[model samples]
Target chain A: MTHILDIKDLVTNFYTYEGVVKALNKVSFHVNHGSTFGLVGESGCGKSVTVRSIMQIVQSPGVIEGGEIHFSPDSDNGETGIDLLKQTERFMQDLRGNKISMIFQEPNAALNPIMTIGEQIAESYVFHRKNQIIEKILGLDRTGENLFPKVSANPLFLPLYHLALHRPDAFLLELIKKVPFLRNWDRAVLHTAIEKSVELLATLGIPNPDKIVHQYPHNLSGGMKQRVVIAIALASEPVLLIADEATSNLDVTVQAQILDLLKDLKKKNIISSILLITHDLGVVNETCDRVGVMYAGNLCEVGKVTDLFENPKHPYTKALLDSVPKIRQIGDLKSIAGNVPNLVNPPLGCRFHPRCGHAMAKCKEVFPEMTIVDDDHEVACYLYH
Target chain B: MVVVLFGVSVLMFSILMSFSPERRAVAYATSAKQIKEIPILVAKYGLDDPYHIQYIRWITQIFKGNFGYSTVASSPTLDAIIKYLPTTIELNLFSMPIIITLGIWLGTIAGIHRDTFIDHTTRIAAIVGWSLPTFLFALILLMIFYSQFQLFPPEVISDHIDDFISDNPDKFIQYTGMYVIDGLLNRNFEVVADALKHLVLPVVTQVTVVIAILVRVMRSSMLEEISKDYVITAKAKGVDINTIHQKHVKKNALLPAITISGWLVCLSIEGSVTVEFIFNRAGLGLLLVKAATQLDIPVVLAISLLLGLIYVVANLIIDVLYAVIDPRIRLN
Candidate 1:
């Protein structure tokens, strides 16, 4: 299968008062097209940083020291591919919410307060597919011939003479004078755009889209707002959707519902792939086809979900699996030893050496590179290396 | 919600006052004639009605913009209220923007730079602003700027545009209630400049304390907002630092700042008394102070009602603004 997104030797660092923190160290992973890839790790293990780096969304004090994020568009000819890391912000803006989109964790806070749900969703649609919406609204779709004749022979009352008679400079000056800052003209345009936006919201799952479109973000319930955000991300039919702990903030029931919605949408829309960043191993087991285990800031293991769960190779993966409580059994679950090491001054050799039960003297002295143990399984530990 | 409670309390007080035989005694000095007229005065003011009925009548009159005649001034209380309201509004409008802008900007900078010299200076400034009595500050400012430097005149400046227009009979346009508006209307550029210059010291004196408080509130709120998970999330998203500040930090910080601003505006009317006295400005503060000093019950009651109404309305606006700024707040 062709890789939709590839990150090679990613190293992200944060400059802080304490010291230089290596947030992500030599992280490398590939997410194939139409596949659900799960990145599971403890808090502060750089799972979120990796996903954010893919979308070119890292902020100041934190820097991507070295990395390459290559996203390939899944066209028939495979002609569209771009290195997102090297692209300008303008280019990234064009790509974001169109070719790639993100579903944030706290849906309540993520949506803009002043903006209505419908308007926010419609903004993505208008921005990415302006011509389509305008054409549809104006009944100007030209799928047939005689397009030129239709344009020339149109019988609608033309304001050509009126427009011509009003000199552009004079007209503009008059408009400015009457509006006192040209506020009214902008409002007229905005009002039309907002009207069309309500129509777009109707296409989403919002009930009474017209009424909901006028209501501010505060008026909607948490679930309704999350649906609105989902609608926004899916407006442009992006090929890759990054759900960064998307269900973490929600209750267990809501989490299950949202997860099911995402899964359902993913299957129906076969063109898109999901990159699910989560700390919940259970969520990964249920929703992911492939899983990548991260330790500290390194990708410790990568394998098919079934294989990894059935016969985990990496020590970190084994410990994580062992820690999960099984419904069939009734005993206390095993817990992973030690907390994640501070990235600012990480231990020498293996960053996970202090926590790994299988650590050897060699593990403490030499850092291991990822070694492919099988056709679909890779582990970055001495056992596999 | 608070308005409804206040209204009820005022109604209850009015009813309690009506039943008491001392209504005339309270209204005027006790004498043989006054004692005979006590029941008549009570009946005239509808003080004889039941508490609920009297409350309804009072509320209806207030709704119809009939605040009732002043017992002391023998003039319409509403008119007296309307006359003083514009002056208070002018003072507030001049000072509010300065306070909000200066506070947010200085506070944000201080918060962002925590222990730096700018931060330290801002902290000291906020401490002084919060701790110092408004009356003392007003007096000090008056002595320094007006008495010592002679930079400001010790009176409210009123270039009556109506009188000016009547005298000149050419410039009639009045877009704003400000002198600047009148100056511009008559095409008097020099007059506009002079007006602005004259306004400088008074506006500064009125706004200084408010600006200091706002800065402190904004800084603390910004600091708290900066530490939220979403800010970290935005950072991880590789969003520009400036975008994070503008979109994430600023909006979240606005919550507390806005809440404080509402209360501050309400309190400012009361707070302005000392400042008004110091500047010798004929604003509501001065009128209220004078009314209270002279035992002018009618003026005092009118002023209290007006202040209460303004406070209620301002709080409502603040609540609406909260919904505007933060989507998490549900209006319903």
Candidate 2:
């Protein structure tokens, strides 16, 4: 079966003052449909970088050197994915928040502080769902209190409607838009977008969304703000929702509520797949169906959560599992030896070689390839090979 | 606001009053003969009275709309301000919008196209603007545009138009002292055009001098906003880079710029001295600076209080604008 999202040999590098920091080293993983794929790693292990590269939203000083993000929403009937990296900016612009949306780590930071909640959520619709909103506007009745009858009353209505239908950046639309009160012709589309925003907010379980729509991001509680952020992501009904440490910043109770909301949305088939990035192993154990363990810009292991937890193959994965402090049972948690290697000049061969107990001469000379160690389990280590 | 203004006036009055009574008496003297009677003039204005008594007397005079006499202008302080304030206001009215919008637009482009040729070009412009002394820049424009090309004369209005307005009151009424506005009100477009022509160099000097700081402030603010998580969130939500910068980042970035701009307006009031003096335009800056050279404390005290009022008003507007832009600041 075709996976919902597949990342192949993704290499991302950060050009900083010191040197080229090799942040992501030929990382490859595939997230299946209708399941939570958790990527757990320490801070700066390139988990966020991986998803940012996928979304093509990586800030400057960092570049996606080489990568093929194969995204094909239809997983059941065998449709080969399109390389997202190869798509044009316009294509990517539409694809983002429409097909593949992201829920950021800090809800406090994710929502625009200056913008009202309605405007923020409506932005997604305004940017990507113009055509959809236009279609909805076209179906609105020509009479009786809808914005359409009044819209049709304008002299430039037909031309503007046609221009809006053809391209959002129509020259005529811009020319006539300077005088705020004079631009009555385009109000129908804007009205529809706002209406859709309120609907999306209500669907995402935002309380008093009608009033909340007009309120700024700062007015909301942490959980409500997260819901607003989630509402913005889910505005266009994205098939793949990438939650990048989304619940990491919230309190325990809020985190649980958000997690439950995400799970419920998934169960209801509102979202096709979730690519959850977090360093919390417990969170992964509870929520994810599959897990990918990352270390020093490399994906060391990926498998079903059960298989990976019960029988972690890679030495790095085993070390990571052992490091997690258990509830009321740990004597002293065992940490992997050595600092996370400086990615600018990571160890030449396998990045884990310096810390791996089973490191051999060959392991120090060559980076190992992924080798299947068990059913639905894969590990990138010399021992596995 | 009233309390602040009153405090500003008292502070300014006391500083001016610190000069010896004989020296302060010079501001009250009109002629060489009167200069010789400094002691008599000092007693007449109660110049040697205790500070509070003198301050109370000054405040009572202000309540009666008497701003004392300006030795520099050879007129009352109120009349001098009325004559010069409009010229300064008109000059700024033309340049302020251009300075603000152009600086903001350029800084935004530089920020968004960061580290590119466009960004570098703007940085160079900002540096040139910042480093070039106002008088030198104004003189260079004067030499090139006024002397060499004879394009714009360095006067508030051309001699003929000035004479025409003064000579032909029926033909060209001075509805407002601002020659440009009055010219338009009087339907004398020639006067308006002449006023604008003469204004070009002074406005340019003000813009070139005042704009560097604003651009720097705006550029840094834009850069900070660009790195904000909301900006990334906007980007991740499929918002175009332009929309993200314009709608989301620009509004958030404008808070610091607003404060800087309020300061710019205040600074420009003081900063216009060089431009006005060089350009031969009678504005508060040049008037106050000339008064300072002659130790004319009355004009100095009057203009200082006026500037304080303007600063307070500008800050109030800025605070209101800030609260409007960022709701988080509303409560505060």
Candidate 3:
């Protein structure tokens, strides 16, 4: 199997007035190509920070101090992938929402309130797909050499339109553009973008996409807004979609619907791979092929979802799996014994040894590297070593 | 809006009516030499009548466009407003744009460069501008520019330009009462230059004093907006850093500043009394001061009504602007 993303020795910290909050501590993980990968952890356990670091969008005061995130965008050349953390911010800006898109947690606050749905979706297309859209416009203009007689007849306008579409910063088109009536070409080009947005909305199964495109975010329900947000992320047809708790805020029915939509998208080959960051164990169990269990900024276990659920290795992973109640059980719902450690002053060595039942003297002395115990299953514990 | 204006007028009338007929008769008396005629004037205007009757008489005269007379200007109250309003309007026209653009620009840089030297300097400047007394600021500027350098003078225009307009009616048409505008119409750039020179200090004083609140509003609003989830979403969606700040964040930040700017418009148009008085410009604010001091009730009442009307119109314009900037707000 080939890996799509690999994070090695990633360290992220938040500089604050109090002290440095160690958000991510040498966290390492990977997502397989064409497979759904889930990272599951407790509420404050740095799951979001790991993905945010990948996209290079961590807020201020939170800095990626050191890491090497090699992204294999071209599946055939996975061995020599480019290091994402070493790339320039300009390169990252071009890659984000184009090669690797992200969906945020809050649906109500994700979309801009003042912009129309069509405009919101079209923004990504305009930013990353301008050349594609411009080509589309040129194709439309050359349909049997008679796309629109008015535009085609004006030979002067066509060349200027080409120049306007390409070198928009030039003063030639700007002079002509200042004439109020010459704005027709702008509307025509914008119409192409809006049409593409309508198609994207339709693919998301939004009803009456043509009408919905003209509506604002405030006009939509919670589920509908999430769908719109998803549609926007899918605007550039990224190779990897990072859904950061995308379905947590919706009701049960809507959450099920969204999850099914994600599953359906994968099946239809509409999306290549998904890196879903969620806290719901049920969500991870049903959808993910592979899972990584994290405990207070450290990845404790990584394995196939079925193996991790049935025969969990790391003590924390075992405790986490035990905490979930089955459909028909005779025993009490087992909860973890101790609180998750604070990241600012997390315990030295293994972060979970204070609560682990199998605490050894070495568990308090040194942190353990990930060790493969079985085929395609790894655990970060002295027991595995 | 009309009801509100009516309410304001009634309130002012009741306050004026609280005084004795002899005291209220000051509105009718042309001069203090006619002290003996105070009773006769009171009788003629029914100043001693019941409250409702006095209110009805005053409201009737206002509706009939007979705003008594202005002893200060030696003309009708309406005529005095018409003659003096242009100077105040011109002063605000120059200062309001400077106030709005400068405030928004300073606030945007301050918000973007949070905790940096630029932010600290702008914040301190805003604080000083806000805390300093308006009259003191105006006086200091007047002393520096008019007294020290003698670079700029005060009042509406130089005596020569005023004389030119009054002396040559056929040669230079007074198309508008504002000399800067009318000078251009008449192709008299000298008059325009003279008028603008006199405008510099007052406009400076007005903008410096009034822009502080707007900057504070804009800065805090910008700080709040850039932290919104939509901004993060924009960054996530591969938007260029410049567009995220200038377009998405700025458009949201300007919403609060728009409300503050509405107050700015009214504050300027009612014509900063301190600015007009310190500069000795014959605008409506100066006229207002003269009217109030002389107990010229008709002139004071008319000015109050005009201010009430201006507030209503400013509110309507603000509503329109809000609808334009924010899609969540719709105007019917």
How many backbone clashes does every candidate have? 7, 0, 0
List model 2 lDDT by residue over B143-210, tens digit each: 99989999999968888888887898888777778998998888778888999999999988889888
| DockQ of each candidate relative to the true complex | 0.17, 0.86, 0.80
**CA error at residue B116 for candidate 1, angstroms:** 11
TM-score of 3: 0.94
Tell me the deviation in Å of residue A148 in model 2.
14
After best superposition, candidate 3 residue B180: deviation in angstroms? Answer: 0.8
| Chain B TM-score, candidates in order | 0.78, 0.95, 0.97
Query: TM-score of chain A for each candidate?
Result: 0.85, 0.93, 0.90
Clashing pairs in 3: none
Off by over 4 Å in 1: A16-21, A59-61, A74-81, A131-225, A248-264, A268-270, A282-287, A327-332, B1-90, B97-151, B158-198, B215-255, B287-306, B316-332
lDDT of 1 by residue, A1-385 (tens): 8788888999999899999999999999889888999999989999988977777676557898897888897734364367788888867766777888888878877766655665566556545654443343344556643211111212231232233233434565455546564423323223444565565556555678778877776788787777766766776678898888888888888788888888888878833799999989899999999999998899999989999999898898899998888988667788988888989999888888898888899888877999998878899999876
Tens digit per residue, CA lDDT, model 1, B1-332: 66564784485447344435344334553467776777677667665667678667766777788766654444676766666655566667777777777778888888778778999999898888777777677777778876899776555454563356457645545444455556777687755665565556566766677677788888889888776655543433334456567656787788888888888887776777777776776667877787666544456656777677777888899999987776667556
**lDDT string, candidate 3, B128-219, tens digits:** 98888889998898888889999899888999888887899999887769989998888889988999999999988888888888888889
- Candidate 1 clashes: the total is 7
Proportion of native contacts found in each model? 0.18, 0.89, 0.72
